[model samples]
Target chain A: MSVLRKIWTALRGSARELGDAVVDANSIRIFEQEIRDAQAAIDDSKRALTGVMADKMKIDRRLAELNDLIADDEASAVKALEQDNEALALEVAQRIAKREAERKEQFEIAERLASQIASLRQKIDAAEKIIADHQRELSIVRTTESVQKATVQIVDNIAAQDSTLSSARSSLERIKARQQRLDDRLAAGEVLARESGEQALDEKLKAAGIKGEAADANAILARLRARAES
Target chain B: MSLLQDMTLSLANTVFEGHRFDCLPISGEQEVLQVQVSGLEEMPIYVTVTDTQILCISYLFKKSELKEGSINELNALLLELSLPMPLSSFGMVGDRYVIYGALALTATAEHVMKELTTLASNAVDALQTLEPYLK
Candidate 1:
């Protein structure tokens, strides 16, 4: 195949792989965004829980102050009753008893609020853990995406280098072919002329009283011996 | 003026008269011409010519080894022509032809050397008129 064709094919494959990697990376980004949103929600819930706990503490302090006021009024009621002020003493006792009941109810409500705050805090902690785990997962996905991008880039670079090398090799081959054709044409004529000259010289040597036949006979005998041994 | 057109007429005359090589004027890139000198057989010497340079780009001959005499002769011709000889491992740069001495000499020492010298002399004469421009 041609170099251009090969390069095109390689590029198509690389693009396909890169497309898949992009999709995976985008999916990871979506997961990452979701985790971030969840973490934000967890943070908001934690802030609300802090407010609930503070409110519960405030209610408990109010209940304690009401109990202290009930105690002081009750002591004053007992002294008034001992001084024979029955009506005043009765009114003070009734007020103290009413305040005590209110304090007890407030303490119960505060306990319930504290319980709700604990439950909400547990939910926030669980959500945070999930977000943290998702964040870790997102990081892995990002790392994978980075590696994939590098792989694609490396493949592209290799393909480019290969194409350049192939083009250089093809050019060199064409040059060599042209040189060979010229060399063959020039050498063929010279070789023929040399062969004829050699033949003529052999003929002259034969006519000049040189024993060429004797040398040929010896050469034939040597070839026969070598062949027989093989 | 472009180097190719400026030297076309002189280059044609020199190639035909001095070297007995055929000249064909080229049009694109520059006013260059291609010259072909017929050797012993159908093998022809190929060269490219312009006003500033005459290049023996290709030749035909065969030998396993190159001689030192041919190398020295090529260097001398390059000096006379005021052209840089191509390094063996380098490629062409612009209008200059890159060649390796080892490869040229190995292929055909006598023929390569002779053609190189003739081309070099022709180039020197053609570009001599432009010496003041160079300085």
Candidate 2:
């Protein structure tokens, strides 16, 4: 990819990450806002429907008035025709035709408005149902998100505690080994000191007749060797 | 003129300076007039006029208007305010919840207007308290 394309891709990825974070943070608020907005839209749809219906009613009334005017004028036209006043009959017929034409136009407009209002109402109703479903889904996910986050944090804490416990156990073993080594070395030094002290005491005792070697060939050999060396 | 018609004319002459008084279009043994109040938020109140008394009823809301999830809460709120509402108490007509007040036909026009206004006000008040459940 070109450098610009790569940069654009990175920006898109970051934007998605940011969007995910925002959704995670404000999921409930966004859902509530959607509900509010949907309700407002529904209300607007209802108001528009009401206005259109009013217009249709007005048109219907006008059509009714036109019908009455046409009927009266037609009656007058028939009377004039019977009276042999062709000019008056023609004028009345023309007036009735004009009224009829206006009525037809108003009726068509009213029918169109009625249809538009019906279509709009259906669309708004569908939107409300969809928003309601979204709200239900969001509520369920909210609980799941809370519990999921809590459990994840708990797992992380336990993992951290396990590491600390492992180090503590290893430290305990190392300390115990050091203690045992110290104890062993001290024991060996004590044994040597005890043996040397006993030997020195034995020599003193032999000279002073308190402690002495065994009276055997080894003692004679040791005396002869000492005399020879002297 | 009929007793109800006389009562209505007297009512219009006495209390309602500019209120629209139209007879209800029901073929029954009784004469009823619908009183459209002079405010945008107020709904039209219906008065059943008999030989002896006038019962004015104003619609509060429909059972269908009550949200299913908040029905219990709305019912509880209705029960809470059932006894303490001023002038008029909550009543039901089929599936419609209403508020109403009654007066003898012999009652003064002021008394009639008071009862009608009381019913309307109570319905409006109940709607305000139960708005959340309504939505």
Q: Residues B45-134, candidate 1, lDDT per residue (tens digit)?
A: 233332222334322111112233464454354456444433212122211223312222133323444554444333333223222222
Model 1 lDDT tens row, A1-230: 33234334533564455414433445556677878788888888888898898899899889889978998998999899899999999999899989988988998899899889888888888888877776655543433344334333433443355431122233334445656888998999999999999999998987875649876787889999999999
Candidate 2: which docking quality band? incorrect
What stretches of model 1 exceed 4 Å from their correct place?
A1-26, A81-85, A154-230, B1-135
The interface root mean square deviation of candidate 2 comes to: 32.9
Chain B superposition TM-score per model: 0.31, 0.78
All candidates: TM-score of chain A: 0.52, 0.49
- Per-residue CA lDDT of model 2 for A1-230, tens digit only, reads 23234324533564342112213446457767878888888888888888988988898889888888889998999999999999999999889888888988988998898899889889799878968776655644442233233223322343364431122233234435655777999999999999999988878867875445654556789899999999
DockQ of each: 0.01, 0.01
Query: C-alpha displacement of A175 in model 1, angstroms?
Result: 38
